[model samples]
Structures are given as C-alpha cells and as structure tokens.
Target: MKLNIQQETAQDFNAVFELNKLAFGQENEPKLVELLRKSSAFIPELSLVAWFQNQIVGHILFTKIKIVNNENDTESLALAPMAVLPEFQQKGIGGQLVNSGIEEAKELGYKSIIVLGHEHYYPKFGFEPAEKWNIKSPYDVPANVFMALELTPNGLENTSGLVVYPKEFDTV
Candidate 1:
C-alpha cells in the first residue's frame, strides 16, 4: 500500500471525526477529538492522519499535558484516541500514525508522551509502564495500560507526579 501520513488540515475535520467514530464504534472518541481541537492542549502539528489512495484510513493525536510534583511542573505530551477504519485496522495504518506522530512530536521539542492504551500494542513503540517514571494517570486504569515514552534521552528520568489532562478528556 502506498500510504501517506500528513498533518491534519481544517478540511479533514469531518472525515477525521467520522473515522474516529467508526473505528471505535462510539461517539466518545470523536467528541473528544472535537473538544481537543478547540482546547489549548491541541497540537495541530501532531494531529496526523494516514491516507491510502486518497482516502483517510487512520488518525492519531498528541496534545499538551503536564506532570506536577511538589517541586515543579513539567510539560509533556499525551497521545489519545488513535483510530483506524475497521477495514484498515490490521494493515499497519495505526502503526504508521503512531510512528509519524512520534517523529513529529520529537521535531516539535516534546520530551515525553503518555498514553492509555493496549499494553501489547504500545510497547512496540517503546512505551513502558508510566510507573517506571513514577508518573500516574488521572484516570484509574491498569498500570500496564497507562504507558509513557521518552522522546529524548533521559527525558523522563526522575520525573514523578500526577498527570494533568485537559478538561475535555474528563468527559470520555
């Protein structure tokens, strides 16, 4: 497949919304995407979509988040609601979105990323338990499912704190 990964544009909003809704079989994720787009956390450069033969097949988003401790607060990135059309699920479209998103985040100077997702799937991208860095998700979820990745060397070293997500995420 000749796949293209690119930053999402204003014109792609509806298609990306529908793609998220269809991929997850629910409206929550699509709603989250819409809310994130309007929130300060949204990173336009990290909002990416995968295309094949001119049709959008997958989408991924990275947004601003913070890790706060007694001493200081650190800026970080959060990956959420990654989705691919059901027909395109196993064809590596999601993986392509993730890989491309990571590269874009690195270029944009983000140091770390947090995600609540499949334990098996994320590890391939070098995501490990967030607890390894003493980071905790605001939502109560299995430790293994809430993971983090360092975009730079020692990016997360000694960082320990509570993750603060955008208000929009609380709805989902």
Candidate 2:
C-alpha cells in the first residue's frame, strides 16, 4: 500500500478528524484536533495527513510547546496527539508521519522536539527521556513516556524546565 504524507488543507480537515476518532475509539481526539487548529501554536505544514488512495488515513499534529525554566525563557515544540485510522494502525504510516514532521522541524531550524507517547514506539525515532535533559511535563506522565530528541547536539543543553502545552490542549 502506497502512502503519501501531505500538508493538511481545509478539505482534508474532516477526514483527519474522523481518522483520529476511529483510531482512538472516541470523539475526544477529533475535538482536540479542532481546538489545536485554532490555537496560535499550530504549525501549518507540521499538521499532516497520511493518504491512502487519496483518503486521509492518519493524522499528526506538531504544535508549539514551551519549556520554561527558572529564568523563564521559553524553549519550544513538543509533538502530540498523533493518530492513525484503525484500519491503518499496523502499517508504517505513523512512522512516516513522524519522520516527516521531524524533517519539517529540522528545515525550520527547530533545535529540539519532545513527545509524550508510547516508550517503545517513539524511541524507534531516537527519543530519549526529557528528564535526561532536565526537561519535564506538567502532568504526571510516566517517566518513560515523556521523551525528547535533539535535532542538534545540546538542543536542551543546560535547559531544565516543564513542558507547557498550548491552551487548546487544556480543553481536553
């Protein structure tokens, strides 16, 4: 099965939402995607859809997130709310979406990326615990689930703080 990952547009929006809903078995993710779309943190190209036969079958959103330390300077970007349609779950579409996001971030000169996700799945893309860099998430997620990847060396060097997701995420 061939898959194409592309920048999402207005026409693809509803299909992406429905894909997330089916993948997660709830309406929650669909709503979260809507909220993120309106949030100031939304990164246009980073919001991607995976297409199979031109139908959106997976969705991944990379919104601007912040890590504020004692100094209060904000270091940004954390990946979240990634989902794939139930029928597409075991395929490598999810990995392609994530890799595509990382490439976009790199080209845009983003220093680091953080993710709160399955330990096994994320590490395949080189994510290690954010704690290794003294970065943290405000919520009590498993230590293993809160992970970070430096697109450049010392991306979080000497940066210690909490990951603050955008306000849209607070709606969940």
Candidate 3:
C-alpha cells in the first residue's frame, strides 16, 4: 500500500488517538500519546502519522528524555507506544513511521533514542541493548527489551545512566 508519512496536525488528533487504541487493543497507548503531547518532552517534528487513502493508519512519537549521570545529564529521544491499525499490521506502515521518525530526529540534532519494546522487533532499526552503554530504564524490564539507538557516531559513548522519562509516563 502507498503510505504518506508526515508530522501529525491538530486535525489528526482524534484519528491518531483512535488508531492507537485500535492498534494496541487497549487505551493505555492512546492515553500515553495524549499525555506526551501536553508535556514539555513532546517533539512536534517527531510526532508522525502514516496516512493511507486520507485516513491515519499508523502513528509514532519521539519524546525528549534525560539520561542522568553523576557528571552531567544528556538529552535524548524516546520512542514509545508506536502503533498501527489492526488491518495495517505487517504492512510496513509501522516500519515507515519508525524510519521517518528516526530521520526527522537526526535532522533535529538528536543524538540518541531509547525504546522499551519487543526484543525481536526494535533491533531491525539498529537498536541495541542500552545496557551496553550502561544506560538503564527507570522501570525494571529485561535488558533486551530496553534498547537504544545512536543517531550520531558514538552518541552513547561514555554515557552511562538511568533514563528519566517525563512525569506523564508515570500514569501509564
């Protein structure tokens, strides 16, 4: 299917919300998206949607997160709650959203991205165990499920710490 990936607009809000719920078969992801939108962490350019036949079929969000260390804190992006309509699964819509989001993030000068997701899936996008950089997720999750991707060369080099997600994430 031909899909157009672009930054989501205000008019796409309702559609994106529904898409998230339908894709995940739950309300958590949709609620997360809404909360992130209102937080200081939201990255407008990285909040993207996949459209097909004028309807939104997929969505992806990248939010600002802090990697706190003893010496200093580094700002990085976090990919969370990406979703695509049920009928759209396995059709590359999700991949497109991910790829587009990553490209846009790099253009915006983001150095790294962290994702808590399927162990088998995210690796295709160059995501590796964040533990390799001594980066840890705030929540206790298996190491492989929490991964990071460096957008710039050695972006995570010497960066060791815990990822601090926005407060809004606490509810979900």
Candidate 4:
C-alpha cells in the first residue's frame, strides 16, 4: 500500500483516535494515545499517522520514558501501541512508520528506543533484547518481547536501568 506518513496535528486527533480504536479492536490503545498527548511524555512530532486513499490507516506513537536506576535516570523513547488498520496489516505500513519514527528520533538526538512488542516483528528494525544493555521493563515480560534499539553507536552503553513509563500508561 502507498501511504503518506506525516506528523499528527490537532486536526488529525479524531481520525487518529478512530484509527487506533479500529486497528487495535479495542479502546485501550486509543485512549492511551489520547492521554499521552496531554502529558509531558508526549512528543508531537513522533506521533505519526499514515494516510492511504485519503483516509487514516495507521498510527504510531513514540513517547518520552525514563530508564532509572539508583544512580541516574536516563531518557529514552518508548515505541508503543502502534496501530495499522486490520485490513492494512502485513503490508509494510507498520515498518515504514517505525523507520520514519526512528529517523526522527535520531534527528532529535534520542539515544535509544524501547518497545514491548512482537519478538519476531521488531528485530528486523535492529531491536535487540533490552537485557543486552541491562535495560529492564517494569512489567515482567519475556526478554525477547521487551526490546531496545540504539539510535547511535553504543547509545545504550552503561545505561542499565528499569523503564518507568508515565502514569498515563496505567490506563492501558
């Protein structure tokens, strides 16, 4: 599918909400996206939408999250709740959004991105087990599903810690 990906705007909110709702087959992710938007964790530019045939078909959000240890609290991006309409699944739109979001993160000087998603799907984008960097997710998930990717060489070096998602995440 040919998609035109763009940074989401206020004008896109309704569509984004509906698109997420439909894609995920539930309201949690859509509601989470809405809450994140109003929180400090929100990165407007990283909230992207994919338009296919003049309609919203996909949405992806990368929000600010903290990786904390007793010694330090490092910032990283959390790639969460990425949604592509059910009908649009498996056609590379999700991958495109991920790549575009990664480039944007690098451009904005982010060091790494964390994701709790498919063990198989995310590896193609260079996401490795977060444990490789001693990074752990707050939720007890399998090592493979909770992955991390460095935006720069050794970006996650010496960055061991627990991921602390914002309070808004509890909603979903």
Candidate 5:
C-alpha cells in the first residue's frame, strides 16, 4: 500500500486520538498522547501519522526523555505508544511508521530512542534490550520488552540510568 507518512498537524488531533483509542482498545494511550502534546517534552516534529489515501491509518510519537544518574543526565527520545487502525494491523503500516519516525528522530539529532514494546517486533528495526546499556525502566517489565535503539553508533554508550518519562505517561 502507498502511504503518506508525515508530521501530524493541528487538524489531525482528533483523528490521531481516535486512531490510538481504536488500535489499543482503551482510552489511556489516546489520553496520554493529548497530555504529551501539551507537555514540555513534546516534539512537534516527532508526532507522525500515516495516511492511507485520505484517512489516518497509523500513528507514532517520540518525545523527549531523560536518563538520570548521580553523575549525568542524558537526553533521549521515547517511543511510547505506536498504533495503527485495527483493520490495518499486521499489514506493515506500523512498520512504516517506525521506520519513518526513526529517520525523523535521527535527522533532528536525537541519539537514541527508548521503547517498552514487544520483545520480538522491535528487534527487526534494530531495537535491543535497554539492559544492554544498563538503562532501567521506571516500571517493572521484562528486560526484553523494554528496549532501546541507538540511532547513531554508540548512541547510548555510557548512557545509563532510570528513564524519566514525562508525568503525562503516568496516565497510561
């Protein structure tokens, strides 16, 4: 399928919200997206959507996050919640969103991206266990699912600490 993946605009807000709600079968993720859009960590360029013909079929977001240790606090991007229309799932729309988002984050100079997602799916895009870099998640999750991807060589090198997510994520 030919997809038009682009940065989300103000007019796409409600469509994006409904996309997440329907994709995830809940309200928390959609709510989180709204809250993140208003938070300091929000990056307009990283909130992307996939348009199939004219309607939104997929959505992805990457927001600023921090890795804090006693010594240093490093900035990174977090891929919190990615979703595609339920009918559109497993047809590569979600993968297209991921690949597009990665390129966008790299172009914008983000070093690495953190994600808490499926252990198997993300690895195809080069994501690995965050434990590979000593990074820890704020919640209790299996090491394999909480993954990180270095957009550049050694992007997470020497970056280790607890990921500090925006307070908006607590709503999830």
Candidate 6:
C-alpha cells in the first residue's frame, strides 16, 4: 500500500488523537501528544501524519528535549511517542512515518534524535544507544531502549548529557 506522509495541520488534530489512542491503547502517549502540541517547543513541520483515503492512520512527533551534561550544559531533541494505528501495526506505516520524520530532521539541520523504544525495531533506522554518545535519558530504561541517531556523523560527539523533555512532559 502506498503511504502519504504530510505535515500535520489543524484539521488533523482529532484524527491524530484517535489514532494515538488506538495505536498505543490508552497509554500516556496520547496525553503527551496533546501536551506537546501546546508546548512552545513543537515544530509544526516535525509533527507528521500518515494519511490514506483521507483518514489519518499514523502520527509521529519530535519535540525539543534537552540533555544536561556533567558540566551542566544541555543538548536537545529526544524523539518519543511515535504511533501507528493498531490495525496498521507490523505494516510499513510506522517505518514510513519514522523515515519521513528523520528526513525532516535532516533537512532542518537537527544533528541528532533520541528515542526510548524497542531495541530491535529502531536499529533498522540507524539508532544506537545514546550512552554510546555519552547521552542519557532522565528516566531509567534499559540501555538498548534509550537510543540515538546522528543525522550527520559525530552529531553527538560533544553532546554528553541527560536528555530532558520539555517542562510540559514533566506535568504528564
């Protein structure tokens, strides 16, 4: 099936929420997505939707996140809360959304992306442990679960820190 990836617009708000609920099945993901939308850090173009027959079937969001280093300096962008409708699971829709998002990140010149997701699933997109880059997440998760990808080589070379999502995330 051909998948169409487009920048999410206001009209897609309700559909994106419904899709997230169905895809993650009533997790904090849906709530976080809503919060991210209102957060100042949201990049409109980075919030994407996958549509088919005029229905949104997938959604991906990349919000600005910070990583605080030992020197107390912070780095940004911790990719999270990506979802594909339940019926669309295991199909390539999720992959397409991820790839599209990554491409968007590249075009915007964002150096790296961090994700706490399935160990097996993300590596196919070139994500490896953020720790390898001296990057860490605020939450405690398995090493393999907290992954990072450099859109360009050495993207994280000077980035050694604790990844912090926006303040809105703290409230969720």
Q: State every prediction's TM-score relative to the real structure.
A: 0.98, 0.96, 0.98, 0.98, 0.98, 0.94
Q: For residue 9, give model 6's deviation from the true position in Å.
A: 0.4
Candidate 1 residue lDDT tens string, 1-172: 5799999999999999999999889999999999999999999999998889889988999999999999999999999989999988898888888999999999999899999999999999999999998999888899999999999999998889999999999998
- In lDDT terms, which candidate is top? 5
Full-model lDDT, candidate 5 = 0.95
Residue 94's lDDT within candidate 2 is 92
Q: Poorest 10 consecutive residues of model 1 by lDDT?
A: 88-97
Which segments of model 1 are wrong by more than 4 Å?
none
Candidate 3 similarity to native, TM-score: 0.98
Steric clash pairs (candidate 1):
none
Quantify all predictions' global Cα lDDT against the true fold: 0.93, 0.86, 0.93, 0.93, 0.95, 0.85
Weakest ten-residue segment in model 6 by summed lDDT: 69-78
Which candidate ranks first by TM-score, i.e. highest?
A: 5
- Cα shift from native, residue 103, model 5 (Å): 0.2
Record all residue pairs in model 4 with backbone atoms less than 3 Å apart, i.e. clashing: none
- Higher-TM-score candidate among 4 and 5? 5
10 residues in a row with least lDDT, candidate 2: 69-78
How many steric clashes between backbone atoms does each model show?
0, 0, 0, 0, 0, 3
The C-alpha local distance difference test score for the whole of candidate 1 amounts to 0.93
- lDDT tens digits by residue: candidate 3, 1-172: 7999999999999999999999888899899999999999998898999989878999999999999988999999999879999988998888888899999999999999999999999899999999999998999899999999999999998899999999988988
Q: Could you tell which candidate, 2 or 3, scores higher by TM-score?
A: 3
lDDT of 4: 0.93
